[model samples]
Target chain A: MRSFVERHTFWAIVILLAAVLFLWMIFAVWPEWLIDTLGRKKTFVNTLLNGVTLGGLYFLVASGFTLIFGLMRNVNLAHGSMYLLGAYIGYEVADRTGSWFFGLAIAFIAVAISGILLQYLVFRRMAGDDLRQTLVTIGISIIAADAMLAIWTGTTYQFSPPDWLFGAADLPIISVIRSSGDAVYIKYPIYRLAVLLVAVAVGVALWVFLNRTRIGMMIRAGVNDRDMLAASGVNVQMVFVLVFAIGAGLAGFAGVIGGTALSVAPGEDIRYLLASLVVVIVGGLGSITGAAIGALIIGLAEQFGLAYFPTYGVVLTFLIMVVVLAVRPQGLMGGR
Target chain B: MNSSRLFSGSFSLRELHPATIVTVVFLIAYPSFASNFFILQIGAYSLILGTIALSLMMLAGYGGMVSLAQLTVAGLAAYLMAILGDNSMGVMGLGWPWWLTVIVSVLGAALFSTFIGAVSVRTEGIYTIMITLAVAVAFFYFVRQNYVLFNGFTGFAGVEPPTLFGVYWRDPVPFYYLTLTVAAGFFFAVYYCARSTFGLGLQAIRDNPRRMRALGFNITLHRIVAYFFAGVIAGFAGVLLVWFNGRVSPGTIGVDVAIDILVIAVVGGMRHPIGPFIGAIAFVLLENFAIDLIDRERFNMVIGTAFLLVVLFSPDGLLGLWNRFRDRFRFRGNALLGAERVNKDDPASTGSLEKS
Candidate 1:
């Protein structure tokens, strides 16, 4: 136990403790007080639930960024704009077809195509050059954001799930006032649960793909030694294009999920992009596990900070980034 | 070892003697002849952005650290100015004299940037970008959420320039000269700094950090100084920006502005001091007039396309294109000198035009 604690002390242990303190504050020590402060236990439950789902969305977007950064030293500043493009496309598709799954499928493929185009057209020429590539991506993002604004206007768009997941799910637990016996069941949105489940399923799939497959091995090898990988007859360029497509596709997919949960607007793209950056930095670049760990901390901190402090919510998030950066510059789980 | 290497790195290898003279004459005479719209809206605005972008170029070109928080440092100055000086918004303006406010704001910006630099210089390449970006975004949200400090989204306005020597500084002609003077002063500061021991050493450190460290150079200390100096320049521009707009707000220093600053620097060509000003002129003109020509909402699309094409075609920027166009009219002997200098400064210099 001591050894295990020591192993995860800085990374997993810190996150675990944060999550526990939140739970203890809400669930154990001050449930009645929270109910009093918030006016209802349902609101508290919803807030906590929102944090988890938000974290899941962050995990989905950040994993793709980590994967691409790990394999190639390229920084895609356009990732968020691509995500916005996906969400906008998904919103249109789902609105037209009235089918949720079809929208997700189309948005995923379409965004993957866009990502590939970006690689073949822009990033391919600037191979191994970080600054120029970053600047190019920033320009792409700016153009993409502008294009979306032209088409979608400035209004926010929210997605509705298919019939099976359209409504809220009522749980067995109820919040009751100690004096009046007034009670209410905590009802959670079914779509948020779906988002979480989808995120987890994708997480497992990615782990398997990275750990147990041939291309995954090549990717790991590519990350470690690109020159040697190319010398060994592995097509490094092909792998880069592949990873870029997959990373962008994941962001697009998450965009659909996040757009559904929080609604899509003109500015949400940068917000999510910044969120992904914080997650990647906190999780350590190029580590999927680190991405997940980083996402949870950011998501919880953001939502929790908003609930408690309101005004200082973003500050809390920034403080976490600074602390993590100072404590472990390479990130908690990042080894290489 | 030529003293003229100061104006621009290899990209705009034109000697400063001719170019500086030409640019200065044009600038000084611009307000006297150009219409108010041209002077105040386009020319002055370009110079302001150009100054800020030049600060970014200093770090990126010489130090190899591309900071996204330049706008934030500049905004810090404007915010301090709004808080300290007389303002229409009856909020935090302490009603200090203009001279004291400007001094304090500029110094405050330097101190703020130094602290941020200490934290960020620990990382390199993409990590440095991420950390500085985080700091910029954090400052954006900090001002937006903390309403009492910055008046939230509405932002304090009516931050007017003080009248001195019976001259209204906010008048379009006077403002143009004011901005021009500051921008020109800092442009030369960057020029002279490039030729100094610190600037040359920074470039050497950028090319080979370990070798410089082994030879007893303090890499961190140098990087931090670069950030401080850049911040001071940006702060000067920010004060100008606030006076130009006659207000201070969260919108001015947001993440988009930070990225726009990067676009300006890169599109101008980070290799030279004049590149940023050139890029800034193009950007301001496009932003102001492009909306009339194209769909207003689609203006950013044009900018993005331009930025991409510039990066792909001439990574050194428009100045690079000018260099190519002018090289045909040049004597061949200087070209040989350029090649020899490249070999001396960076022997393994990839024959990439981007580097040259």
Candidate 2:
């Protein structure tokens, strides 16, 4: 970290100044001119929070996608299907058993098992053939999507979080100063904050697992050279199965969480799939840190675009992707 | 002598195979016997879709780049035609002449495709698919959201083909012939280009980009040019598609339709130019008749299963399966004919398989 700052002093100074300005914006009462130009401080803070939380959700979906692609070189076009299926399964279980946490566990396990079946039955046979594998996944997604529609129909279903997570929580930051000279604190949803916390925990855990653990080391090595990893007496296929299961499980877990935050419907699969694809593309393929940064940028761009330009919101995300492709085709964190 | 042969090769009827003559005759005479529904929906629709899929096949099969944005390119042309020409929506219809609108639309789509290609060509292999798919989805969302220009969700309707030479072109018979002519023109264009220097160079680059680069070829330029050629074909098909449907909507260029184009190209057999048409005909037939076998909503399931089976069993699709069968039959025939005959057919069969 120190070396990064030292080597790129100009960039470091720019980042530091930006961070300080952001901190000031968050803490200080906004001037009348600022509020006139940028709207209420409440909306600005809420948009910022929403974007961060949305980024957390995107990170959950894309990290798994990047992991599988990093290790196995499989694009898994059916991943969006897995997410929708997970949400559907979670909704059903939660509705039936009345335990949202149980539903989450069940969704993860169910989707992970399906991932194993996919790896074993479909991907295993055509291993190392990227195009064919991608095509097969597309076929699988089409079938799965239709089959799901047959079963679930077109209705949107939203999950009910626990009573404790149902309402908003007040934060320390002041949104406005009332005529009485009293500051009014900002209120945000508890569930979204929890989701953000969980995402951070999962990300740190993933970093530790990949960087410190032996199996994680093996997975990293496999990503670099599968043949060499296998030849070195490691069970490479076993490692692949493990990675696929975890990657798929994260998607399933995120689906339940996302379904709660948003809603589950027929077209949500395509939405999340697009999200993961764009995230990975901007962040760089096969990099966890890249996915996180990519997701945050996309999420913020989307929320702010919606708040500011409403009509051309989608163009902002697309412009970011095009710029990234033009300037850094390998991605922000992706290795060449 | 070689140049003369090359010139005559594309035009000579005597040099054409017997099957080609029969097919052309059948197509020219199709409108007389076929019903209006069959002519417009099955025949003309298939031809337009096949032409669009052919653009994808040209890029994927020959260039070794599988892009999911071909339909998006076609969609842009459709939207351009609707916006620039006449439309009932009264949004941005400039009431331009049909010929000018078509020329502009085609050029617009080609330039858009070139831009997409330039951005995508920075990466290699599987990245192409992801990048193109994202671009396709982005276009879908953009058109659906921007109301001032694109008309948002409702889109443009009552988009009619111009009447020319004292005939209403949108009528079933004329439309069928128009589409057939265009499809056949592109079909043979792709066929001829496959044997031309540019196409052969593309195939060589697909096989070994490093070696092609070592040989002083401009790899990126070759690919971008391929994209421009494909865009023209897709752009023409897009114009025809809007005229056929009499409308252009965000739904017309949805992500599902994009994938369907890929499915058609893959299912038909990407090895040759004829593959997309064969795939499109089969797709249109199944789409029109799948209700007889199963629920209309479950057609995706059936096609998806068929796609899975094709990918699993024969990656080169129906053409590969047919070629294998013929090779086996030819081997048996050669066993009885002569060992020298077997040797002559060997390289041809292997060469065809290696093209993809």
Candidate 3:
């Protein structure tokens, strides 16, 4: 961090000033002119919070995508299918067993098993052939999407989080000062806050798992040089299967969580898949940090665009991606 | 390489293969015998789709870039034709002459495609697919949302082809002829280019970029130019496609249709210009008739399985399968001839070599 600031002092200072301004905007009671120029403080805070939580959802899906790509050099186009499948399975399980957590667990396990089967049966045979592997994934996604549509019948399904996680909580931020000179706190959904918390915990856990653990070091080594790792007496195939399972499992888990936050249907796979692609592209392929940063930027852009410019919300995100590609083709956090 | 042999592959009637001659003759005479349904729905539709898929094949097969945005480019042309020409939507139709509209829409789509190529060519290989897919999806969502220019969800309709030379061009026979002309034009254009200097350089870059760069080729410019040519083909096909349907909608360029284009290219074979047309015919036939064998909803499943099988067993697609089968038969014939010759020379050795 110090080295980054030392190397790019101008950028660091600019970022610091932006951070100060942003913090001030979040805390200070807005002036009448400011409110007239932008909007009510309540709307601004809500949009900001929504962007952050949505970024959390995007992180959950894209982190796994990056991990798989990093370790296996596999694009895994079927990832979106896995997400939709997980959501469907989660919905069914939760409905039957009367437990959302159980459904989440089962969804993760089932999807992980499917991922393992794919890695073993399909990808193993065509190892080192990147294009063929990606093509096979595309084929699988088509079949899987059609099969899911047949089973689920295109109905939108939203997870009903438990009663405890339902309802909104009051935040400490003041939205407005009433005529009586009393400040009104902003109220936001508890479930969204929890989602953000879970995402942060997962992100931190992933960083530690990749950096501190022995297995994590092995995985990183494999990502850098699979042949060298194998030559050094590592069970390269086993590591690959394990990484694929975790990656697929994370996507499945996010499917259920995101389904609760939003909703799941036939086309959500493509939506999330596109989101992952853009995030990974902007954030840098195969890096968890890159995925998180990309997700946050995209999520914020989406919310802000939707709030300010309704018709061109998607274009805003696309413009960000184009700009990122133009400036840094490798992505924001991706290494050369 | 001899310069004569290099230039020998240019399009010329005298050099046309017998198969090419037969195919052209059959196509010209097809409408006379076939019903309007066969002529329009099957023939014209396949040719239009084949032309579109041909663009994808040109990029994937020659340039080694599998773009999912070909349909999006086609959709852009279709939308431009509608918006710039005339539409029933009472939207922003400029009511330009059909000729003007076609020229503008095709050029617009080509420039758009060149821009897409410029953005995506920053990355190589698999990243091409991901970036193009994102761009395609982004365009879909944008068209679906923005009503000011794109007319939002319900896009322009009542689009028609011009009546030329006292002929309603949209009529089945005329449409088939029109599509056939365009398809054949692009087919031979791609065919000739594949053997041209630029195409060979592209294929060389696909094989080994670092070496090609060392050999002093402007690899990036070559790729962008390839994209421009592909865009031109897809743009023309798009104009025909919108006319065929008499409307343009967001659904026309959805992600599903985008994948369908890729599936068509892969299944027919990406190795040759003729492969996309062959695949398009098969796809059109399956799309029309698959309902007879199974539920309409299961069509994707069947196509997806066929795609999977092709990728798994015959990566070069159906053309590759045919080549392998013919090679085996020819090898067997050669072996038999060799055995006979050996027998004439030495019977004992021939027995040892021929028993199997």
Candidate 4:
């Protein structure tokens, strides 16, 4: 325990806590109280839940981005297209099969195959050339987007669960609050719970794969030093393709889940692509833990910003990124 | 050692004579060939995009930073002009004249770019690219949502072109000249800057930042200044874009178009000033006619394939190909200086485009 506490990170965290306490005592207490006294509303609990739920979506997207970027140094600008495709596929499947579960499965499989093909055919050919790879992927993204627009038209597609899972749950804690003159609303969406569960499941599986499996070891090795892994006779090319496919599949899966939660529109690709970038930027590139943490922070910031200050929601996320970048160019998790 | 060996590295093998003369003649004669429509609309569009590509070239080709937000700055400028001018349909509009709006918008864009630069310049390579992308995305959403100023999804329209010397300036010939003159002016300015001390500093930073920092140059400041300079050019191009479209729409300045500019710079050859023109020509022609020839759905496929082919076969871009062919014939006299040992693989020298 002593040895663990002596770790550099532990000591720094302790120092950080001390600073936070000092700041709270010096700056926050009196002003916060005064504002509370002056008829300002505080939503500490509401914002927390909002951030966590929204963060699940971010996690779903950025997780895939991190994995692909980890194995292949190539930046797949077309990741967003995959997500959008997944949503469209899921939407169609749901419409045909009338089973949301089957729709999710079909979307995931379809996206995985397409992603693998993209990796093997296009991305594989453009390895070791970052500029060319970026340009090509960007071109592919534009094509994909145009094709989607052409096929889907410029309409926003939405999805909702069956009657059994239609509405929110009113727990005793929330129902009990209604006794007061002022009514407090506390209805939790089950879809959010499903997303939260999927994020956890994916997280655990990813952790196990990277830590316990031989292929996972290779991926970890590849991220750290591809040249060394190649020198060690590992098939670096195969790893890149597998990593890309898996990452893309994750995004597709997330898209299916996210589509049910959020509307899958024509321009959602660009928005989610930017979200992925923000995740990778704040969370160190290729770090799953970083991606998770970054997604949570950004997601929550976005949700609360929307709820509290609708006009400045986007700007708030941008500010967070800019501030984080100003302080740490490497990110919250430093890049290798 | 041969006398030329010591002087060879110092003096460029090809002199700057024919290329310069040709460029000057082309600039002078371009407007002559422009019929009313070609002169005013197409010509102006080409020049505006070319100028934007010039600023992008300075960053991508010279500074080695691929920025996707350059168009966002242009969009912001356009939005600012609409929001600040008297003729604007926007809420909270200052209703200022076109002149004041232009100046203010340009300044706003410069400030935004500088802020982006301040954060992005701290990192190198792809990190800088992603950082700028985040900034662009954020600004895009901000403008898309806030209805009072940006008009939400519906952007400002009816931005009339400037009138000077009693001319409405919307006519093809006058607008053509306006864009051509500005493009020419910016072209020379960038060329001169590239030839100046600042240009050398930028090149040094691009080639080796650690060494430049070791040598006591303020690398961040140089990068930020480059971004500022680029933003100013983009801002001007934005003003022109509104004039050309007769309106500004969020759809027009989307991420796709931003990426398109980067594509143009790379396709034309990030190495040379003339590369953007070559790229712009190809792009404009492709955009105008490709949909008719192939399935409109597959138009991007053609562009993607073209970008991939260029990058794989010729990193120097189309202009680089022209230079190589020109060099093959121009240096035929001396066996040592000629085709057998033709060193056309160097990207920097390709952009330099040495003349004989």
**By TM-score, is 1 or 2 better?**
2
Name the regions of candidate 3 deviating beyond 4 angstroms: B1-14, B333-356
* Candidate 2 C-alpha lDDT tens digits along B1-356: 24453323234557888988899899999999999999999999999999999999999988888889999999999999999999999799999999999999999999999999999988888889999999999999999999999999999998999989999999999999999999999999998887777777787788778899999888999899999999999999999999999999999999999999999999998888998999999899999999999999999999999899988887767776776666668786554454344334532111232223
Error of 1 at A296 (Å): 0.6
Clash-forming residue pairs, model 1? B10-B356
Q: DockQ, in order, for the candidates?
A: 0.61, 0.70, 0.57, 0.47
In model 2, residue pairs whose N, Cα or C atoms come closer than 3 Å (at least 3 residues apart or on different chains), thus clashing, are: none
Model 4: colliding residue pairs: B14-B355, B15-B355, B40-B172, B86-B95
Estimate how well candidate 4 is docked, as a DockQ score: 0.47
The CAPRI classification for model 2 reads as medium
Query: Which residue ranges in model 1 land beyond 4 Å of their true spot?
Result: A6-26, A29-44, A172-177, A180-184, B1-16, B331-356
Model 1 local distance difference test score: 0.84
lDDT of 1 by residue, A1-336 (tens): 778778877877788889998666555424556657766666666777888888999999999888988988778878888789899999999999999778898889899999899889988887778877887888888888988898899998989877777789976556544566665566788988888899899999999998999998999999899999999999888998899889999989988988888899998878888988999888999999999999989998988888878778898998888888788888878876
Task: Give the per-residue lDDT digits (tens) of candidate 3, residues B143-258.
Answer: 99999999999998999999999999999998999999999999989988887877778777776788989988889998999999999999999999999999999999999899
What's the candidate order when arranged by decreasing DockQ? 2, 1, 3, 4
Tens-digit lDDT track of model 3 for A269-298: 999999999999999999999999999999
Q: Please write out the lDDT profile of model 4 over residues A1-336, one tens digit for every residue.
A: 556666777787898899996445323323446446532222443455667877888888888888887778778888899999999999999988989889899888889889899888888875766666766777778778878888887899887667765677652222112235654445666777667778878888998999999999999999889999999999988888788878998888988888988888888999899999998888878888988899999988998788778877898898888888888888899664
Q: Pick the candidate with the highest DockQ.
A: 2
**Fnat scores for every prediction:** 0.65, 0.76, 0.82, 0.60
Expressed as tens digits, the lDDT of each residue in B1-356 for candidate 1 is 34464334432446657866887799899988899999999989999999999998888888888889999999999999999998898989999999999999998998888878888777777788888888898889889987777888889899999999999998999999999999999997887787677787777777778888999888998889999999899999989999999998889998888988888988887777887898999999899989788887677788889988887777667866665555534736577565445435542122231221
